[model samples]
Target: MNTGRDEDALRWDGDDDPTLDVGTRTAGADPTPDASGHDAASGEDAPPLALPDGFTAVGKDSDTVGHIEADGTVVMPGDKAPLSSPMLITLGILAGVYLLFTIGWIVGGLRLQGTAQFLVSPVGYQVALWLAVAAPALWFVTAYALTRSSKSWVRIVWLLAGLVVLVPWPFIMVGAVGTVAR
Candidate 1:
C-alpha cells in the first residue's frame, strides 16, 4: 500500500507542467488537421514546395526516362562523365610502362656510350646512335606521361614546369662557360 501511494504522489506532481500539450502525446502520428489533431496549414493555405509542376528526366542521351518537377537538377545528354576505373587504370599502367621503357633506354644508351671505344669489340657508333635517338625520345615519352597521368596531372604539371626551369638553366651555364673559354 505505501509503495503504491508514493508512485501516485509523483504522478500527481507531473500534471502542473505548463509546457505539456495534446500535440506532444501523438506528435509523429500524422499531419492531419482535424478536431482530434488539427493542423493550420491546410492544402491550399500552406506554402508551396519549390518543386516545378512539370519537367523531363533525361539519361545519357536525348531519351527521357521520367518526369521531374522544379525540385531536381537534370543531367543533360552526352555529358563527359567520369572515366571508368578500367580506363583510368589502363592509362596509369601505360604511363608507368612508357616511363620505365624511356628510363631503360636512357640508361642503356649511357652505358653503351661510356664503354664504346675501350671495349674489345668497339661500340662507339652504336652507342652514340642509341644515345642520340633515345635522348630525344625521352622528351616525347615524358610529355606523354604528363598528359596521361590524370590522377597526378597537377603534380605532373608542376614537375614539368620545374623541369622547364632546370633543363635550360644548365645549358645557360654551360654556354656561358664555353663563351668564357673562347
Candidate 2:
C-alpha cells in the first residue's frame, strides 16, 4: 500500500480487503494455490467479481432487489410507483365525466345548429365547439400529469374544481332535449 500521500487525494485502504490476495505474493508474481487447495489466482474459483474491501458476497440470488411485479414492471428505489386503488378509481371517474362532456358537446352542437348561428363562420363555430368539448379532458390529463408528485388530496381538489369550472355551457343550455317552446 502506497503511503505519504496528500490528504485530499482519494485513497483505497486495501489492508483489510477480503478480496485482496491473502498470500504475501508480489504483483505480477506466479500464481499460487490458496488454503482451500484451489488455485487462488484462478478466476474460476474466485468470487464472480472482486468486491471492495470489507464487503461480502451476497450471492446471485440477491441480485433481484427492489420491487419487481409479475407483469415485468420494475419499480426501483425513489421511483414514482403505481397509483393506489382509490386514485385509479378517481381517474376512471374523471375519464367518464370527460367522455360525458364530449357527448354533451356533440349533442348540443348538433341541436343548436339551426337556432344559434355562429357569429363568425360555420367552420369557426365547429372549431370552437370541438375545442370547448375537448377542453375538460385536456385539462384533466394536464392536471394529472403535472400533479403526479403532489399529495392525493391536492390532486383531487384540483380535478374536482376543474370538473365544476369546465362544464360544457352549450350542453347545459341546449342539451339533448332541444329548444323548449313556451
Candidate 3:
C-alpha cells in the first residue's frame, strides 16, 4: 500500500514545534490595549505610531514617511529618486558640449603642431597638446564628483563654469573649423 511519495519526508522534524508558529499567541500572553484602546496586533485606526530611532518624518501632516531599517538608518524619498527629465536632458547636453570641446582641442592642437615645434621641443609640445586635449574631460569628471552631494543647480553651475574656462581657443581662432586659414 506504500506509494513512492513519503509525506513525512516533505517536512522537517521541527515542523510540529509550537515556537515555529508565528501567528498564534503564546499560552499566557494577553493582548493589551495601549492609549486610545487599540490593541497593538489589531492595527485598526491606530494612533500615529512612534518612528524607530533615526527615522525622520517628512511632508506636510506627515502623510508619507521614509523607510526605517532595523539598524535605525532611514531611507529618504530623495535619497533614491532618479534624475528628473529636464535634469537628464541638461546633463546630456552638457556631456555633448564636453565631447565637442575635446574634439576641438584635438583638431586645434594637431593643426598647430608644426608651429608649436619651433617654440617648444616636439616632446614638450606633444605633452602639452595631450594635456590640453584631456582638460575638458578632466574638468567634467572632477566637477561631477565634487558636486555629487550638492543640489542640481550647483552641479550645473560648476559644469557651466568649466565650459567657459576650458574652451578650445586655438580651435576657434586657427583650426580648419576657424574662419582664419593657415
List lDDT for all candidates, in order.
0.46, 0.69, 0.80
* Candidate topping TM-score: 3
User: lDDT score of model 3?
Assistant: 0.80
Q: Using lDDT as the measure, which candidate wins?
A: 3
User: Each model's TM-score?
Assistant: 0.28, 0.55, 0.61
Q: Order of all candidates by lDDT, from best down to worst?
A: 3, 2, 1
lDDT of 3 by residue, 1-182 (tens): 98846786798889989988756445555455455547566544433333665656776635334565575565544455457799999999999999999999999899889988999999999999999999999999999999888899999999999999999998988876576544
Off by over 4 Å in 1: 1-78, 115-182
Is candidate 1 or 2 superior in lDDT? Answer: 2
* lDDT of candidate 2 over 10-65, digit per residue (tens): 65676567778555545785474443335655433432223333444476534323
Model 2 bad stretches (over 4 Å) = 1-76, 177-182
- Listed per candidate, the RMSD to the true structure in angstroms reads 18.3, 15.3, 12.8
Residue 52 in model 2: shift from native, Å?
25
Best-to-worst ranking by TM-score: 3, 2, 1
